[model samples]
Target chain A: EDQVTQSPEALRLQEGESSSLNCSYTVSGLRGLFWYRQDPGKGPEFLFTLYSAGEEKEKERLKATLTKKESFLHITAPKPEDSATYLCAVLRISEGGSNYKLTFGKGTLLTVNP
Target chain B: GAGVSQSPSNKVTEKGKDVELRCDPISGHTALYWYRQSLGQGLEFLIYFQGNSAPDKSGLPSDRFSAERTGGSVSTLTIQRTQQEDSAVYLCASTSGPSYNEQFFGPGTRLTVL
Candidate 1:
């Protein structure tokens, strides 16, 4: 079974503080690693996709890096508006042949206090 | 709508009642997916539909969970005899065609069983 685990179930950061969220995964033939941000009652917003190890992608104050077994989302000098849950997911082939599905982590709840 | 949209953003129901959640994917997109997420858990894949291909129902948790995509456009997820354990946010997403592309997500339907 493909599995994804995120670290530090919750985090509280003062405005301007920087930190990183971790996502570890175990899958058979990784197709992609995805990052999403979800607010209180809204759907998840797509953030980035890292296809290969050593691949990195950045948007505004967030930077995502991936390795063989894990991925990290780095936030720098975040603002209160950046506070939200960060989700990590992986896409891989299912045991059912030619089929694939996304396995997501529980996600890290980020609170950026101004 | 430009992005995926779901109906009945919030639902509160009795444990024995059945519920149907709806999703409208982006026009021209050929892949759609359904997922379930408990309060603090990761997303659990439920089902998937792609263009002209057999729908993948491997992630469905039980026989009570079923989904259908009518005419290759909108999709519906039905959960019968709901249990308290079934309370969660049901999310829907879609991609253009391949499984590797970024999947756009809907706001999700928050289901609460009383």
Candidate 2:
């Protein structure tokens, strides 16, 4: 079974404060790693995809890096609007074929106070 | 719509009632996915539909939970004899194609079971 775990169930940060959220995973054969941001009462928005170790992607205030066992989402000088839940998912190819299904983590809830 | 959309943004029903949540995927997206988000449970994959093939329903928790995608455009998730455990936000997303693609999300439907 594919499993994903995230750290810091809840995080509180002031405006301009930087922080990082961690996501660790264990899967049979990894196809990809994904990051998503979700606001209250809304669906998750895709942020980035890390295909291999030592890979990183940046979007405005969010940056995601991946290693062999875990991925990190770094927020730089975040604003109040950046406060939301961050989710990580992994793609595991099925035993027989490449079935498209993502195993998701419990997510890290981040609150940025202005 | 430019993004995925779900109907009945909020629903409140009795424990034994049946409810159907609807999802409209992006115009040209070929891959659609369903997920559930509960407090502390994070995001759980419920099902996935690609084209006209058999949906990947491995994530569905029970036989009472079922879903269908018609014409490869819109999808509906049905829950029979709703239970308190079924109370959560049902999220839907669509991607252009392939599991590696970025999936766009919809504003989920919040289901509250009494």
Candidate 3:
């Protein structure tokens, strides 16, 4: 069974504080790993897609790194506007080598206080 | 360009009633997906549609849940005999081609079953 787990269910960080969120996964075959940001009352926004280990992608203050077993979303000097639930998801390759379903973690809620 | 869009930002219905939620994927996008997010739970994959292929309904929780994509553009998710447990945010997303691409999401429809 493919599973995704995210740690630090909730984090409170002061403005300009840097922190990292973790997303661990166990899958038969990993096709891709995705990160998203979701605000209250809204759907998730696309962040990054990591296809292989040792891969990294960045946007503004957000950086995402991937490994064979896990992924990390690092926030650098986050601002109040950066507070949101960070979600991690994985696409697993099925026996037929074709699958579109994404298994997601519970997500990490970050509260950046101004 | 307009991203994926869902109708009826909010829906409130009584138990035993039926409801339909709609999704319009980004123009030219051939793949569409639906997911559910319950309180304190991770996003759950509900369905996937790619081009003219049969949808992947394995993620649907029950037979009461059904979805269809018309013209490979607009999709609708229908839930029959709504239950209190069915209350959650139904999110819609789309991708250009395959699962390896980043999915663009809509604002989601907040479904409340009374």
Tell me each candidate's TM-score.
Answer: 0.96, 0.96, 0.97
lDDT of 3 by residue, A1-114 (tens): 889999999999999999999999998778899999999988899899999999999999999999999999999999999999999999876555567558999999999999
What tens-digit string does per-residue lDDT give for candidate 3 at B1-114? 787899999999999999999999999999999999999999998999988887888889999999999999999999999999999999999999986788889999999999
**Residue runs of model 2 more than 4 Å from their true location after superposition:** none
Candidate 1 Cα misplacement greater than 4 A, ranges: none
Chain A of candidate 3 compared with the true chain A, TM-score: 0.96
Runs off by more than 4 Å, candidate 3: none
Q: Which model scores highest in DockQ?
A: 1
Output the lDDT of residue B89, model 2: 93
Predicted structure with the largest TM-score when compared to the true one: 3
Ordered list by DockQ, greatest first? 1, 2, 3
What digit string (tens of lDDT, one per residue) describes model 1 on residues B17-97? 999999999999999999898977888889999997889998899999999999999999999999999999999999998
Error of 3 at A10 (Å): 0.6
Pull out the clashing pairs in model 1: none
| Model 1 C-alpha lDDT versus the unseen true structure | 0.93
* Root-mean-square deviation (CA) per prediction: 1.1, 1.2, 1.0
